[model samples]
Target chain A: MAYTIELFMVSVGVGLISGALINISIGYKFHNKGGLIGGLIVGLLMAIL
Target chain B: MIEVFGLNLLGLIGLILFFGVLIASLRGWIPQDILPVQSALMLTAFILIILAFILGKPIGLKDIQMNIYLHPITALIAGFLVAGALEAAGAFKAAINILEKLSKTTLGLPGTVVILVNIPTIFAMPCGRILAAALIPAAILFGYILAREHKQPALASIVVFGFIVNAAASCGPSPLGGIGMVGEGMAGGLGVAGVQLGSFVNAQQIAIMMITAVTMLSMSLVFKITPDELLIASEEKAEEKREKKEGVSREGYISFFFFFIGIAIVFITQPPIPIQTILIFFVVVIMLVAKISVKDLIGGVILHPIMAMISGFIIAGALVAIGSFDVMIQILNVLAQTPLGYIGVAVLIANIPTILPMPCGRIIAMALMPGILLFGLRMTEIGLPEIATPILLTAFIVNAAASCGPSPLGGIGGIGEGNLGTAIGSSGRPQQVGIMIGTGIAAVIISFFGFI
Candidate 1:
């Protein structure tokens, strides 16, 4: 359970945090939404591993 | 000793006073130069001692001395010595020439720009000042070229500030006296076997690469920093400095080759010897090859961070004597029980260095590492996986290492700001955002790869 929690943190958790942060940094203009989406999908994939 | 919130009265006062003065100085609520954090921390320790004596709980001098871990400090100083010799030998110039030539290759300007911006992280200096000082002129030159070629004045700011952030954060992964070593040492104290000395290096390096990209992006999109807007009268002087440097000497190439080789040997072999011994050995070879004198090596030592580290140790020692760590661990444990729970609190704890950035990350790291270690230990007792230990430590160490970049005090970012003729805290927001994300990514990498 601890390992799963940690795995999620290092993957989707970080990805989501980074996405939101970049969005906030750019004032939610949505220019980098592609990056955010890509990050989520990739992060989820990494988490599933 | 009167107790309050798990801490003795004097310990509570000491902890509050210590953090209060440090945060105040960093925020400029007080005159920093007159009462720097180093002096302030030392004074706090002295006050704790006096109060401890009056309260009949005197902290022994020997106890404080014992808390001062000399391994990382010595390793850091030796690393600086080697860096200084390499600088004096013009080894970095050879590196710059390679980057310059590489700029025109198939990778082209943008690819080379990323590589150039990430140079400090690639080399991973003990002090960002070493690489920043050596490569900033190159950053400025490349920045100007980028601005002219791209016709976007902001590109210069992107490159220069991007490089600055990377250089500043590069210290985290630096195998030398870097903040990571302090964390590594603390984790090693857990008696965990097969924990290599520099386990956190790869995770930090990968995180720094991402950080460099985010910093550049933030500079362009968020801050919209422009070279023309930031142009000061000193811009010409920077250009003149760049022009004055001649071709790299043959010895520069020799020293550069040996420096990387030495680092490689240390990493690959993982010798049982102290890192300081290896560093000194390489330092001598570099000195002989570059014909650098011992006096030149002495010139490389920056006393500020060293003093800050010592002051941190002294205060930490005093705090330990007062049972402050026990109090801190209690608070962490209690916080872990709250709605945020263990993982959330752990995340917050790891990011504290960035939230309360200091001019030198070592100050916070040396002071707080013991508490952090105890907190990790507590978590493990509560069923956090053993793997989480290094993960937490890496995240915190990387954040602390990079926190200096956004500091309003005399941090490495100040060097870049001074060169670019920008406001003192102009680059703060972008760099902070980058570091915040970078730290998160570093945590992820360490956990995902089991770098522990």
Candidate 2:
């Protein structure tokens, strides 16, 4: 059960990181570098947590 | 004296503003194509920030940032990109061709429609519109082939609409990617005690499969469609002509290979390396094989509702920051205390996508699921049966996500309208209502059975 919970959390984490990458990628396309930077910072913070 | 409906002045103000935005967005008064759901959510976030300031409870960027990461925005992003890559690589078209050929075989049109409608369940990525873009065309083409033979265009339309409903409902149970991942992510985020996200995903898939099967069966009966009518083959010469015109490419086969490998990885390992990583790896490999540039891949990713989704997350975060969800929880808790109220809440949540009707209805559901799940958790905390919470919440999630098919404003309905070349308001409305009612009935049944 603990392993299962960990797996779910990891899956959710992967989703968050993937979403952040998408945001950053789109931000890069649109020249919104600030949004990308913000997203990366948030993502890094989320990962550490 | 200023309080209305048990809300203080400030709470009343916040509630009105929230509903005002919600109604305006749903009623198409906001012009989402220009402002978009993302922009709307940002604006709402700004408003919440201001409200927080005025209320002397200023929400810091850190607070909003943390909440932003709460939902499965990344899963949705990955799901869209993976689906888009598959579409770009002609993976879906290849599947359609194979299914089309099968329809030409002994299994017939009914068998073809069954496979076509349920294809997304296996492919299960987040973007229904992309799936619709692939499948709806083939479905309509199949319908036309039937009409050409049987001279009953209505049969074609019924089969097409039935396929649309099935595909739409399949989104909830799609274990590989799609809204199912989003649902699971949200469910996990809600801290629903003892519920495993993977198992929850599998259970939802089973529940959705049951719902879709029943709904499709009922639709066939209503349309008086028999297996014989669906099986009536097109002329041999015509079949040969179609085969010649629409042969699958070598790249398409490769794409199919990559797609299946990804699915196999998911089923076999079940989060061995994280599903998004698997999806990203496949997307990269597909891009290389298909000779699609990084720019094109980014373009495909950008075409999704990422902006709308981000906006949804921001808006949800803002709502939380402003204590709106707390207010909602209180109302839900009150409602859940009674059997009638519990049923009403269940029905209301299931019908939200239809009642709200937005292209981002799934995202909206994604944002709201946490609150609903939290409510379910509250119910459990108050001694409601342990099994009842997840089952009711799953029913709510499935219905809200699947109900999008019938809304003219919904992504699937838009695709159907475009294909049928009829305004959704007129031609697609009946089908929309039919699917909504069908899924609603399915939701009610699932709730009653607690099948999960």
Candidate 3:
């Protein structure tokens, strides 16, 4: 498959979201909401950009 | 010549802070509890936001919300989860058992080590650590068996070294895993202005050939594992005992089938829909058939290296926003204009991860790839051969990805050290450095031959 710019951006977006959710879940599991917030902030930034 | 040190004031600040964060992350200078990926992302975001504020640029949640529309991240996550689900479903164990039996029929412990070490190349899972966690014990067991048979305890070390080389270097050929996908994603990013990223399969094939050859040869010549030792077999009764333990499970078979089905769908259809969604759909089906729990699915498959990748993306985005890549390209561009500058830069890029070892190749790739790609593009734009870009960039990608295995801090090398009861930096360093330099030199040579 051709590697298009559109595809690259989509991958970046998905990576950010999935990564945020995963970290947030881990943080919650451990009662480390600070980490959760940290993850959420990064995720939010990616979403915004 | 806009400002200080060839950077505008904002660019200078970004460059300083970016390297500062990178160095701190690499050196474990951050808070004890915070993950390196986490620190890198948050700090980068904070730096960029502050810089944007100073420059009077509006940054808001509305901008972040747009990240949800992107499709490729889902595909990347799906690839990881598919491997994760299969791993959770006991498919790897079954495969290991089958491999163990097959190894018995080959020469002996050396053959078993070969099979166990190289298994990841064929399986191509996203979770290299998890896969290593599972397989290292099996390797150790075989190593002990070899040591006992040969009456030399050092044989076990040889086996461990061999396993590290094969397993760590196997990341290149995996089309669906974090290593392969991240490399492809970086290549795709470089696909701007009519450059084709080429087939993921082709990259995988080249990675496999180069890594396997370099690693195996090093195992033999450097590690002193002779061909005769590899060809010898364990005692017949011991072989039978291993054979008797091999039994197929219906769940394992089904999980295996689904894993391949996911891969086949990816290869055959090349579906535009986020591949992760498709793979996860298959994973859900496997979970239903195999009776896997929702908790297990989320806990095991979703949380790990996937999160690491997210943090990496955020950090990468922040770097780009702050003009880090532009500065990097300017410096590298100057370097590229010199004699043999491309080779020098390729060597430096290949070794950076080893010097500042991270747990995942994706993190390093995400951080450095833009600069690397821009360097390649600039070289081509400057009248170098078109092949120069991919060959040089591929070399950088392969080395960066493969070097993570030998990282002294909690990567495959750490796992190997843990199993061998050796100190953290002592045992796996040679093999780690060997593979890093070996694969790197191999790529450079291949690229020189225009094979990349």
TM-score of each: 0.87, 0.76, 0.74
List where candidate 3 sits over 4 angstroms from the true fold.
Answer: A1-49, B31-37, B55-72, B169-173, B182-201, B208-248, B257-274, B337-340, B441-452
lDDT of each: 0.75, 0.56, 0.55
Model with the higher lDDT, candidate 2 or 3: 2
Off by over 4 Å in 1: A1-49, B5-7, B228-245
The per-model DockQ list reads: 0.06, 0.02, 0.02
For candidate 3, the per-residue lDDT at B448 reads 42
Arrange candidates by lDDT, descending.
1, 2, 3
lDDT of 1 by residue, B1-452 (tens): 68875556876777788778877887788788788877888888888899899988888899799789898789889988988899889898888887778767654555455556666876788888889888887787777776776567666777788788888888887878887887777678767533556777767766766676687677766688755544632564555566466778999999998987777666656778887888999889998898999998998887877887888888899888887787777777788889989899888988888788888888888888888888877777888788777777888888888888888888888988888777888888888888888888887887767762
B103-218: candidate 3 lDDT, tens digit per residue: 55622334344445545554555556656766665666666666666675555555565556556655554544545455545656656333332233334333433343344344
TM-score of 3: 0.74
lDDT of 1 at B257: 85
Better of 2 and 3 by TM-score: 2
Candidate 2 local accuracy as lDDT? 0.56
By summed lDDT, which 10 consecutive residues of candidate 2 chain B come out lowest?
B223-232
> Which stretches of model 2 miss by more than 4 angstroms?
A1-49, B1-12, B32-34, B175-177, B189-191, B210-246, B302-304, B336-339, B426-452
Query: Which is the winner by lDDT between candidate 1 and candidate 2?
Result: 1
Give residue B212's error in model 1 in angstroms: 1.9
Better of 1 and 2 by DockQ: 1
